[model samples]
Target chain A: MNSAISVRHLTKDFRIGIRGLKLRAVDDLSLEIPRGQVYGLLGPNGCGKSTTLKVVLGLVSATAGEISILGEPSATSAARRRTGFLPEAPYFHKFLTGRELVRYCAQLSGVAASDLDAAVEDALGLAAMKEAAGRPIGTYSKGMLQRIGFAQAVVHDPELIILDEPTAGVDPVGSASIGRMIHAMRDKGKTVVLCSHLLGQVEQVCDRVAIMDRGKLVLEGAVEDVLSRRDRHVMTIEAMTPAARTAAEAALEAHGAKITSVTHPRRSLEDLFRELVTGSRDA
Target chain B: MKDSLRRTLWISRVTFLEAVRQRFFAFLLVLSAAMVLSSVSLRVFDFGHGELKFIADFGFGGMFFFGSVLAVVMTAQLFFSEIDNKTALTLLAKPLSRPEFLLGKFFGAWAVLGVFVLVLASLQGVVLWAREQELIAAAEQAGRIPTTFSIVGLCQLVLLQWLRLGVVIAIVLAISSLARTFLFTVVVGSLAVVAGQLQWIAQDAFLRPTDSPAYAAFLWISTRLIPNLQQFNLADALVLGSSAVEEGALIAVCLSGLAYLVAYLTLGSLIFRQREI
Candidate 1:
């Protein structure tokens, strides 16, 4: 149970055209995602990340290998009962209000009648969707849709939540909103597996990350362990004159260290955008 | 088991809402209603049949034709809309099984068809009753017997037509589970409807002496597999009293429709279980 999701030697092949030419979507992929952490699955458009998620959620069958969720077989209802998934570019029935859609998903996910109202309200509140919950889903913006999608995914209060490209087409504010939701899930000791192409958000939200390419796992490790370079250091100093800079460089050289590069530290564009646009357009 | 059924019901509820909201369902319904209403003006061209029989035939024709179209096109659209819109991805990822999802679609589409049949039958019943009243008045003046439509028989016909549409929906769903595109499913589903309507011919041939075992086997399978949709077209006998239909015969037709409906739904469920969402 320490591993939230265990995928062993997973491979998926799809047939194409009339001849049924085999296309390998996942190539011998194996992963052991731990519990109570935010894990990011990163890859390009066709790198099998979504396919792997689909297999783990049992939406698609694996051509080979075994996958289990919380010590139960992935395809079993018992396993799925404890799992929630929000798919990429999510679409819901347009006629339903956001609240109705969330409530509908809650019922399908087996929320008891006694707790259904509370659970739906809690999830909608967490996604910041309570304001627009009464409106039809067709009226939702991209950000609102993602938020409501997030609400539906968590309404069941599952132990493990899988989100595939949760913020793919959303703005920075919406993306940040989803990030906070993921952090909140982790804080609640729930395992959250995120699949995304936004590396910056992934870096900010995920504790561990696995990168795939050409249907193979290329890298997997703790984000801090893989990203941080122990051999180099960076420091930001304010109001440094040329003389002070030369003096600092000489001091570092005398200590057997060299100033490899000198540059000013700047904020990321996403951070800048979020700061300039303080309020969400959807709000 | 209760939870599974509850989940299935939820899916069906949403699906029913979605199908009803479609413009296509509304369009076919309006068109069918117009046909049923217009049967009065068109009664003169009944080819020498009684006025009530002509009106009954007209209404039944509208129901049979438009109901089949709605069942075929709407069921396929209902199923494919989910897949194409990727809503199925969100739904199938839950604890729901493929059979539950398929059955939900079936029930939802069937519910819409039920509404269609009910509306047309009610309107047809009104028209038939009104025409019968006028005919009875004229015949009483001339000392001649007048024809009247049977209320009980109309209700029975409504149920029969609803069951027939249910079978069509089930057949379309099974085809959709195997077919890749909506157009493909509709084409094949329409063909299946046509086959079912003509299945009595296959039964007739099967009962007669056959030449080859292979042909006989084909006929046997066709007769068993394709339901005789014509048997449900007893509007003349049941509604207009052109002939009397035995109670046992009506029950047999109903049982046959139910059997086909179940068989097709089971086949669809099994096929959908293996489908890659």
Candidate 2:
């Protein structure tokens, strides 16, 4: 299959003032987001990461370049029909119940009438929002809001899903829930592109990542390839007595090797929090 | 085509629901209703005009003023709220087109104005009906014919006013598409309404022969560009039957209103298509 999204020589310039001064938002960027994997696009603030995503989604016009989604030219309704987007800091109508909002999006996304109910319910179920789906969105907490936003984005069953900072301002528990959602999308053969500031979460969930700086790509590779140190290694030894440790060190020294450091493997705080607070949901 | 229309309808459905729930809509509805109801008490200062005529004039004036304000301010507020709140980010990122979004907003705000006009017109009808009965009784005792208002004409006036306000909403939406702030849209929209209300002056100037081609060209553009809002102000002819208006004239007014409505909405859609949401 073709890549989920393709961009070539994409550049976007925004005119700043009456004098027509130009500000370059995206400069000669090219990317090929592969299919059926979770891809993270990471950068600091104003690095043009969000602008690149918006250009791919056709929300903002590119001054020069070509973008295609799923083999179709981008910025067309036909191209967008098979794609879903969850924006950064999502805001929904306060008056609408979660279910209503999802249903509204499904219809707008061209969900067939016969399958609309099933699609909406399935989306809500996946986001774990089915229980609070009938309440007004104003009543939802920050985490619930993000979950509902996720539900709306996927309700149409788009083949490509792009989430921009889906977990911003969300607690770790909510963040974990979103990570699971991303995994679910990947399992279903959907292309998931995540733009996020949380490097740890992105490191955990993304199969591959691209880091940008100053409107240019600095690094792009598989997570393991980019992060692994080939010259060094780590080994975990359990239940080692003092005599056994001395013997291992002597064995290594005889083979012309030495241990630089020794320490126990420590679990991350996120893992510890999840373990201690098992079954505690944002609800 | 069918699916696009469906999307537009879904968007307008939410927009209309959001707009009607606003306290501003309810507040204006109450104020306009109060004006209609209070017209009965205020008839003493009619300055020697006919009783029913004064009442009709009072009600029509209330509808015109409040309906225009509601159209200009409410439409801008609805459009700007979606943009400033970043709700447009979510909605526009979907498969929905920019034109569809702008058209949805137009229809939604127009529907709210429809309710405003309907409620006030109904009140005006009731007040006129009550006074007509009393005047008929007194006139019968005095052996003189009683002057009464036409309910059918009042209904016609309601329809015309709704169309007029629809045009105003479309114009405001066009402005809001290019505007960055709510206050800007309102100020420009209010100014447009004032220009449209006085457009008849340019129309008259265009009719007279002019020596200067520059001035004639100015008048020509002015008359054609700004809709003749005065054409729809047929309260006397339509409601009170002060004079007989030709059928062709009424149809011409309706057609003019619809044309401007379509033209302005098209302009808004084109401008909004280029706008970066």
Candidate 3:
């Protein structure tokens, strides 16, 4: 279908304590994630973002609603066959090497025996884990673990990939690497639904964004449409003195324009960090 | 169907590998092996029984006790490690079903117990054979009938023990499906094993006419629901030839074990299908 994932007014509630108190985790959320785009689901902890994803993936049952993946019911294996998932803070068997883990996932995902090796190699190569694939998972750093987790998720070449907090504990370089991977998946005509607290990375990578707050969808739209103000404007000028700034403000006001504020452009700290550590990695 | 089976096989393969690498399995295997070896030295305390019989009983005791511990503790640990680590989230989000996942776990734990039984049974056989030869020579000198053990019976007992442990693993898995924590599963699984051992009491009480209907109903359900684990203790009859076990009776015991195993696995799968992850 045109929509890779469709959630229709989904709600999820959890019971807590011996008293059976109801805790609503997701409240009547509806979404239509378009195919072949990078979509971001963002929220603070306990805002029901993860719960929504879990319900969509059929890891948890919805309290009330309907969800479908690739035109099939969300809970069915037929739907999951076309979807891949990378859980937050992923943990793997420490005894298995990165290669073995990927291969095992491929087997579970039903990769044909003839294509298993090639599929595994391609996924590892995409995650930049081929070099360290032979090392046991226990020896992997947090960044390496995320990368290998990415490798396993995409090993079967699923049409839709859902990644939850893919860069939670990684350095800026690793985070950037994951951002690039999201971009590559989008380039390959695959639908990617990403959930992360890293708003900067989400803005950089997502074509569409949905924000959840307190178990409710507060905002959902294209990144540019939701984030940009049509009335606002910005310009960068080189080598301007105090007199030049006064003249520029006068010139703008004469044309029915007013500059709200003036300030020097500054590089984001993440950009500076990546620039400083471009050649070094925890891998 | 083939694809599902393939997925189950892969899961079980990983589960088996994870279990074998654990220090707990290694420690128990070594301890059981030591108990079997030390039985020869402790034969003087056999309390007037034949030396071969004492060795057999000691080794069988180690197998029964340690095998149950492994079946209960190790099975729960393996299942929980996946849940607590969130590996289940990664695996379950694929095209795999809940029943396939649980069955994979059952086979994996059962395989490890298979190794445990095989190793101990082989060692017991070696010890029995060596002692049998010694007794034969002593009997020739004193003109007495020598006590001997049956090799075929040892093999049969080994199979029965494996099946018994398989039943325990299934029961633990069924408990783990509903348990919120590993500790709960292990505690309840241990209690189930104990009940299975004493299940014959329920069976005996049910066979005799009882006046109380509630008591009879309870006994009736208990006898059917809990396996007669005591029935699998055929080592004395099978290995030492102390009594002749009819082939039909052995078959009946095996069928009973298989029935319990299937019933528990089916129950576990049903409960797990509704579990939240």
- In DockQ terms, which candidate is top? 3
Q: Which ten residues in a row have the lowest lDDT in candidate 2 chain B?
A: B4-13
- The order of the candidates by DockQ, greatest first, is 3, 1, 2
Query: Which 10-residue window of candidate 1 chain A scores lowest in summed lDDT?
Result: A274-283
Q: Order the candidate numbers by lDDT, best to worst.
A: 3, 1, 2
Q: What is the TM-score of each candidate's chain B when compared with the real chain B?
A: 0.98, 0.98, 0.99
* Native-referenced Cα lDDT, model 2: 0.92
Regarding TM-score, does 1 or 2 come out ahead? 1
Assess candidate 3 and give its lDDT.
0.95
Best by lDDT: 3
Candidate 2 residues A18-125, lDDT tens each? Answer: 999998887888888899989999999998999998888888899999999999889988888899889888889999999999999999999999999999999999
Runs of candidate 2 exceeding 4 Å displacement: A241-243
True lDDT of residue A117, candidate 3 = 95
Clashing pairs in 2: none
TM-score of 1: 0.99
Segments of candidate 3 deviating more than 4 angstroms: none
Local error of candidate 1 at residue B217 (angstroms): 1.0
Worst 10 residues of 2 chain A by lDDT: A274-283
